[model samples]
Target: MESIVSELEGTLVKDSDPFSYYMLVAFEASGIIRFALLLMLWPVTRLLDACGMGDCGLKLTIFVATAGLRVSEIESVARAVLPKFYMDDIDMEAWRVFSSCDKRVVVTKTPRVMVERFVKEHLRADEVIGSELVHDRQLVRPLPVIFHDGRLVKRPTPSTAILILLWIPFGITLAIIRIAIGVMLPMWAVPKLSRLFGGKVIVKGKPPPPTSGSGVLFVCTHRTLMDPVVLSSVLQRKIPAIKSELSNGDLVVCPEGTTCREPFLLRFSALFAELTDRIVPVAMNYRVGFFHATTARGWKGLDPIFFFMNPRPVYEVTFLNQLPHEATCSSGKSPHDVANYVQRILAATLGFECTNFTRKDKYRVLAGNDGIVSYTSSVGRIKKLVTGFKKVVSTFKPFIQ
Candidate 1:
């Protein structure tokens, strides 16, 4: 496999066309990775150029005869240069005005994208000298599994897959047992599960006295979908409108009022007002991996379940002191007010930036499916109505649990 990659590398550098200047650059990939790739390609490109293989180095390969290179053009170039491996992330349409043809293409890193401006202002550089930024990022994808396996042949790859196949059954059994325990006996399971995630699930501070003489209701601030589960609470129908009622002596463990991933807390549910005077604010944060589910940026694929599947996964949970009983909607404070107070405390505890946006706003941005119309048919009208309804519902709050 190294030989294949090595040969491919040789071909890319060794066979350059004489008429067109050829040089490789990356704008996005980290410096180390792109530099390594450039080192491999650059030297070979230069050596081939030295051998009169291409009129590359003779001309300012830094400058371009053309700009606005599109994906089709990139495909053509890669085919003529390195046919075996296809690079991704190029601008798809006839877009990506990398630089004007008259300007010199400056092969530089993104962190230094302002280099030209700096030089022109500070060093009195010539205004006529133009630079085109050559942005060829690191390999778009992971090195082919074959490159690592060194078999130069194909079959199963991904070292983790083999490990998973071997221990997956045990993992499944353990997961089922753990999840069941967490559901049935929360006090016993919360700590163990918390430890598995990363931090110990220990009582961080004093908890308030039970609202009812019979028991205490814990309200934790959630950071991920698993917050309820890890805290030994149910998942389905966890939250509805704030007005929903719960049977007396029913232990309601809700965090963040709603299930969302932003770092802020939502207003407290008033339904708990009558049920419990003792409201404990639990704060926990679930970290994201390579991909993220950050609403502030954009929706990413679910990451928590896969996170648990890792061999040595880590998670953490922390508990804040119980909110003052008066602050717990006990002193004529509205549920929303109590929730805001707890959110502020939890935000301080977790060092998270609280925002005003709610989960519905997040959902609308992720998918509305109403904008692209296929002529205004009854179906289209229905879709638009549904979209409008969702937007409306997102703005209002109801009293339910």
Candidate 2:
């Protein structure tokens, strides 16, 4: 197979006449016949349903004739009509213009011998889709498979038959499982979890006067996927923009009131800063990275649509005051270390009393230093420790010394 591929690669011509280009397009198109037939079957079925029995039969006959005509007659017509497609001999001026353009170009030819050679030698395109040709001596014979990376990659396979044998039943099973999960899970679970983690509130830099709309930005840390969810639940409003793919259901579990548009997410942070004081920018401080992981610049080029979106203001939150090395503290200690550490920082910086205590009645271990626990465990321990410290401090009266 490798030797056959190498022989084929060696025969690839640097230039081709018009006849070769048409053959390539036809060869590539033949590989998709089965998939195309399957897709056509649905519309054909619908047509059959709408028509009388005689009409339905006629429609099926027409479909067969149309497909047959394409296979038998289209090639000669296409070859005669298509201009002599040549890429290797493209003038230097044309090459300069083509190279400067940001958009991708599709080069089509019947057999595409010249296009394939040009692609192999010069174009490092994201993708290439073209037909194949078999050559014996000087004669070109169109092949069933398209050549990619010097390999006959695409072949005429019974795609519909394979889909029926494998994919259809699997797809149905998947749909059933998806429906079960979607129906069983509570929609409120996200909000409830967010509220449990100190329901999102506008972290004010300074107390503001009584105003109907305050431009509030919530700057938080980003560590886990749950961070954004928790913050959104606390805020009770959607983050203005999200990744465009997420908007299109690429990312499941869209936040309530949160609509993600790639363009909007890319720029809204800065635009919001300019438009209204009510704009709230929420960011997370990860202990590892010195800055918030999500930033205006980071969002650029991530989505095609983001380039056109309005810019919004972004505020950074350095919640974890200490660096990661400082936060690691003594290992082999109880999880209580986490509680104590958090409490100390809050008390020192925010002037809030934070403590660690065991929730004996709940039969839960509250705090210890082992970091290798679930997020739930860490949150439970932190809450217990902070609550306990606050209680202890409330009861103490500083004696005049």
Candidate 3:
């Protein structure tokens, strides 16, 4: 048995091109005929509709038969029929014909040799779908058909037919409705909706008085595309940072902009600072990794808008920080360890316990009780404690009646 297998492994075989078989199959299949009919019907139907013949369109009722062509022959024909399409200097029609075959053809010159080589090299079909041949040390002899199924057998049903039969008219109706609404409704409806739902203002602390003439480094968590918008609303001022590329045409703010490139961003930042007296830095904490800064995909192309808008008068340096969650888990430290470290750092640097670090419902909330603080929680209880202390101080103010 081992000797036979070894002898068979080294044998060579030849195969018919799979492309020819597929082209033949595609030519015969009713699905292909239906698609062709639809393609032909579209323009004709449009012309008829323009002439008040709204219901007249071609229906696929007959199958067109054609002579079976060889894969090589089809390649030449396709090159002549469609010269625009090319693949690897070979006519794509060849590939299409082969890919459409029902089964890949394989021919073995000797029974002792495996037929796999021929199937792989010449046919390039996912599977061999034909008979093997045996040679008695001299001439080729046909064996029983192997009938291997190719990958093409698992074709998904084409949706185009269904769309033409049922969904096309419905889609046209929906498009008409959309156009009507667009023309009839006020354009402000969209911006108003955006303001109501998309606009978010998160008050980290008391808003600075207008007369104070002081600036702050606004820091918050950055998660969604709407964070900056929300932050700007909360501040009630144009964020000094920058607008993202997608927000370019839509933004009302003049000074801020976003950029992906580093060199251009640095130069813009420097120039903006030179023109603005109050450089309000903005930062966000992303919930992944220990990196202090992240390149936001949406923020690219903001620098050009900022440069053109030109909303500055004096020079000042304002640093923006983007802190991702991964920064907490630095050097393989566990979440608990990182959380504790963050707590300590906040307490030391800010001179107060961190408060309102956890999210509640749709909004972030301060912890109400010690029991609410858990080791598994993403936010620390320190922030909550600080917020609570501030409320108590406000209640006992000396000038209060």
After aligning candidate 3 to the native by TM-score, how far in Å is the CA of 269 from where it should be? 21
lDDT of 1 by residue, 1-401 (tens): 11111111112123223111122222111222332333344455567667986445433332231123443333322222211111221122211221112222222211122233322222222221223523332221222110010000111122322333455466445445444444454354455564554423333555443233244455666554455444432222223322223333324456443345444554444455556666666776665322121212111122233334434433455667656766866688887777677667777887765555443333332222244342233244445554554443332212112
lDDT of 2: 0.29
Model 3 TM-score (2 dp):
0.20
Reference-based lDDT, each prediction? 0.37, 0.29, 0.28
Candidate maximizing TM-score: 1
Worst lDDT run of 10 residues, candidate 1, spans 145-154
State which candidate, 1 or 3, has the greater lDDT: 1
Looking at model 1, residue 36 earns an lDDT score of 31
Better of 1 and 3 by TM-score: 1
The best candidate by lDDT is 1
Which residue runs of candidate 1 sit more than 4 Å off their true CA positions?
1-203, 207-214, 233-250, 253-258, 266-275, 288-304, 368-401
Model 1 whole-model lDDT (C-alpha atoms): 0.37
- TM-score of each predicted structure versus truth: 0.41, 0.22, 0.20
Stretches of candidate 3 exceeding 4 Å from the true structure: 1-160, 179-184, 187-401
Model 2 CA RMSD to the hidden true structure, in angstroms = 24.7
